[model samples]
Target: MNVEVIIVLVALVGMLAALIMDKMRPGMILFSVVVLFLCTGILSPKEMLEGFSNKGMITVAMLFLVSEGIRQSGALTQVIKKLLPQEKTSVFKAQIRMLPSIAFISAFLNNTPVVVIFAPIIKRWASSVKLPATYFLIPLSYVTILGGICTLIGTSTNLVVHSMIQEAGLKGFSMFELGKVGVFIAIAGIIYLFLFSSKLLPSDRPETSGNEEEEQNSTLHLVEAVIGPRFPGINKRVGDFNFKRHYGAEIKELRRSGHTYTDLGNIRFREGDTLVVLTDDSFIRTWGESSVFLMLANGKDYEPAGKKKRWFALILLLIMIIGATIGELPAIQRLLPEGIKLDMFFFVSITTVIMAWTKIFPPQKYTKYISWDILITIACAFAISKAMENSGVADLLASYIIGLSHSHGPYVLLAAMFIITNIFTELITNNAAAALSFPLALSISQQLGVSPMPFFVVICMAASASFSTPIGYQTNLIVQGIGNYKFTDFVRIGLPLNIITFLISVFVIPQIWSF
Candidate 1:
């Protein structure tokens, strides 16, 4: 009824329209929305800038550096090499090999980067043994969807929901806590891929060039490696990697835990680690035969997969993640002194200091690793969501839903909420979807007199249920563009995947979390 509220509604509509049209970069659109609100006096300039001050926003930023450190250290690169399909000339065999880790890694890392690192590599591998790129690309996106379910930081949608829950005076999930359910879902998905992906995934296009089915595959490689717990490179420098001189393959990227790194030399080596290297196939095959580095893809899980070094980045990553998770626990939160958090800023500073001193990611260049656009988008999203709530739009919708479902039990309420949120996410950014849905989930719980647990789960699942459209989830979009896929391609595969996700979340969430 108020003029300000009306303005907020109109501005939100404009924002959504901009996102759908792909009219401008999402960050730009959100910034414009904040500017419009300020000029119209809808939100004070201070309020518009509040998102930048958010601990959650900073935490997201730190995650990027953490990811960067892992990559530079050559951790993820080994993991990719070991997991890819063998060049045995069997399409099904390779798909089976690659899908599981692809799915698992996607769950913990930002799916887009995983694809960026894997797509070309996998495509090339596919070509080496005469497999189609189309078959792998779809599965790549699908697995990311499945894996994202397992961790608090596995996807931005999860973090956005966690932040919303905390904002509403509720405790959020712990890191890998969601893995209890997510891993099961991933296992089932990998099974599905193994049994059906080869048959159902399209390979209509051959490996040949320019028959029109060719033209966009084979830009990455699968080099094997393993790091023992006591390599001197654990916190050492890339310049120390004598293997580069010997193996003739560069450590193009690394993975530790869920992060990826491209700054190779600065990364110190570590034990129990793996790497994915990008080199000519002939070089990989020749090296695999010689046994210079233990080839994980060659069946040694714990062998030194790459040249031995003296460094360890995984320990720091584990400390930050575990520390942050425990700190988030209610009892842990109580024990801590006031005003401290395990946030992005906290971890970013901590990780950066370690990496800088080790010359891993020199502090001067550390700034380059952070994805500022994503941070800006996140900050601006906060302002837009705030405006929606302040204007009563979110409350109005929540009230309507409460009336419609008052007679129904929480099961129907939970299912309805998840379904609605899932649909909304498919159309817009998942973080935005969670932000817009949070108030409604909380208000409805208040009206129903039930604990908000079920609603909270719905918000988490709905925000991440990005199965129906590539337009909504960045990971899907990246693969689609790189894979050169048609829009309907996602619709055909994604619709069923969405249904499975919804069914599992709706049934499993209440059972697991006790709504």
Candidate 2:
């Protein structure tokens, strides 16, 4: 009924509308909501800016730099190569066996890089072993999501939620807290995948029953075409390209930033279109030298120049994680003194600087690895959470939920928070979702007069349980295009997985932590 309450409600509705309609990008939508509410006197200017300076925000930014160091080190490449099943194993069996390795690697390294390394390898393996690449594609995405839930730094969403909780004056979660439940979910999903995965997964790859079959579908030629500014191809229809005569290439797919032009006939080919072709090494070399394609002229194969010390990078990464974990415990934290403490930022910064010293990325290029857009997005999310709290809208929403939850007890409240966070993760980036829900979680805990830790855990899990849609997680979008999957394929596989996560969270959370 109050004007401030009405303003907050209007802002909330606008944010949801923007997410649903895919209007301005997610961070922009949330930033607009915060600015508009602040200018209207719903939230104080200080509240609007509080999120930008939070320790959580800084930690997430630094961890991105750490992720970059690991990526540039060439450590993961060797591990990934070893993960592919050897020649004697059946393709289906190989995928099932590799699930644990895939999930565990994703737990430590960034999932995006893991998939980039594995996609083409799996495609080639599927051909050699006579199996469909599709079987492994969905499982790859699922395992990555499961793995991200296991650690504090596994996903940006976890860091975002951790930051919001600290901003609200609560302790953030431990590294392995979610692992207790997340590992269990992963095991169950992996078992289900192994049992029914081969059947549920489609067989789209070229099936080879014998030598005759091999020759019939003999490997496609690799073609690389450069976009000449004055060429007729620029701004012309893709179907109009004289591929058969001029290039002798079939356009498998075209990537333009985040979008894909899979069905080439309907797409208009523009300059700088990076086409994924299936050609030979000689042609690929020629194309690469001529600037026909920006990258990947050597086909989807790894030809490293030198041997790698995979163990060194792996040990360093583990040391950083272990150091950060031990530093967070009460017993050890007490001895260090007031000024000294281990947060994501400190550990990540130390690790990145050390890695640079070791020439992982040559400190100069380290700046290139950071994703500035994501950092900006995180800072803005903090501002939005503060706006909601000051507007008193979060309080009103919290009270209504509390009254409803009295009958069902804290379990209902925990589940509700988790589901709401998951919905937000699906609708917007995970950082924005965690930001938008922080005030509500804090408000709910206050109304119930309980520790806010359980609610914080809820946000952590929900933000990472983003497997239902491609838009929900960046990893999903990467795999969807690589595998040539339909939208409905994701919906069918992901819906059941989401429901399973929901059910597990509802049952296991209250038992593990106080509600």
Candidate 3:
């Protein structure tokens, strides 16, 4: 490799290390790498800043607002209440009733908010029915992931890949084109979870007597909160910070990884740590939307919009989805004005404005609803992918992969690509994984003289097949904290689902899309 390639490779390694070590926010870590590439002369100024204006990245930001409007309307909350069994039911029966609907709903919205809104409600319902919450939480995360693969706008990773395709002067994904392969994967994966998840997941009943539980439930509010970067006590011992005095709550227990500690006197607080706190019902109302905590469970403080408002929000979302799907048709494309197409960016922007004007979510406070960290991470991911291609690193890696796998045919090459992307996603952010693997996929397809569609589809599936670890996906981390699960718990159950997805992608993608 020449100097540019060597430098890119070294920076790539350093980026991976920083992301794994949790040294900084993922957005900052990725942005730093892009700046490094800019200073090294591998990328022009426009190339370095191009990601900031990417249509796909901007679509993700708009979708966040759309999701928030729906969330504020309490529509998702209403759906969960109706899905849970009113009477006692077996875990299998509950999964039958709940998982499929959740998957379908997730296909249309952001997965993290779906999990955030559904997890606590499901956990509370499970506890009331005497079922273990652990059995359900992991599956909730996995099913949302499965659903996200079914459409172009279902997940940010798919949009990121689509953006790269369009930028390369090729046709991008239709709204539902990925559903050809993704639907099969979702059905098969959900079936696998139904058969084995309850048995594989641990059952840890809370330690409390009937009367004590009854009294605690009636009198005190038990809430679970994850620490955020804005938390004042992030690096201080609990005793030094005086949690009860500042937040008007007592930390009854602290959970990190799989371990639980009751004596939190000297424990230094960290982001993502789950704390089981004993406080009054007013606690959630006081800090529900505050930046001090990443997420607060048992959120009973939110007020639902009026019935008319809820219906309006749902109808608006449906219009956006249907509009985008129709806009991709050839006839519809021809009817549009020159250089103007009615795509997701167009529809989502329109929907967001309508919602904002109608006050579906607060109009002036709309900025708080967006996750700027995730947006930055995605934008930087695009620049990093461009750097890989500009520096010759993607081509070099593609050549080595082809040398080893070409003799076995393109099927083997697809499998190799899936494995590499999956590994990166399991260790780092999925957007970054898709970004890094994308250039290599393009290079490999060009060298083999085959359509790049299958390669592109596999990257979407594999980058999102992050069932084996909580670290890989935000939804998994949210569920892990709320359920108090061990790292090994995910391996026991998610590893099998990962294999199932891998097998399906390698064997099925080519059949549908062709090399």
* Model 2, span 1-515: residue lDDT tens: 68888887887887888877756556677778878877888667787777677676677666666665565566666666677776767655786667888888777766766765566677677667766778887788788778878887777777788777766666777887777777777777777677766666555633111243325566645433334223356666778777545555566667553355567886776444546555444555444322233223233565442345345556778888888888888888888878888855668778877777877555775554555556777877877777677768789988888787776777888888888888988877787788777788888888778877777777877877777777777667656655656666667777777777888877877677776
After the best TM-score superposition of candidate 2, give how far the Cα of residue 303 lies from its true spot, in angstroms: 4.6
| Residue 357 alpha-carbon offset, candidate 1, angstroms | 3.8
Residues 1-515 of candidate 3: C-alpha lDDT, one tens digit per residue: 69999999999999999998878888999999999999999988999889999999999999988998899888998888889998989989999998999988888899977987888888878888999988899999999999999998889999999999998889999999998988999999899989998789988635321245427577676788987656888878988988989999878888877788888788998776889887777888788766677678853634666888889999999999999999989999998889989999999999999999999988887887777878899999889989999999999999999999747878899999999999999999899899889999999998889998899999999999999988899888888888888889988998998999999999999999988
Measured against the true structure, the TM-scores of the candidates, in listed sequence, are 0.75, 0.83, 0.95
What does candidate 1's lDDT look like per residue over 62-132, in tens digits?
A: 67666666655666667677777564657667766777767766665666556545665666666677667
Q: Which prediction has more favorable TM-score, 2 or 3? A: 3
**Model 1 CA lDDT for position 232:** 44
Candidate whose lDDT is highest = 3
Ranking by lDDT: 3, 2, 1
Q: Largest TM-score belongs to which candidate? A: 3
- The local distance difference test score of each candidate is 0.66, 0.69, 0.88
TM-score of candidate 1 versus the correct structure, residues matched by position: 0.75
Which runs of model 2 end up more than 4 angstroms from their true locations? Answer: 205-298, 303-309, 403-406
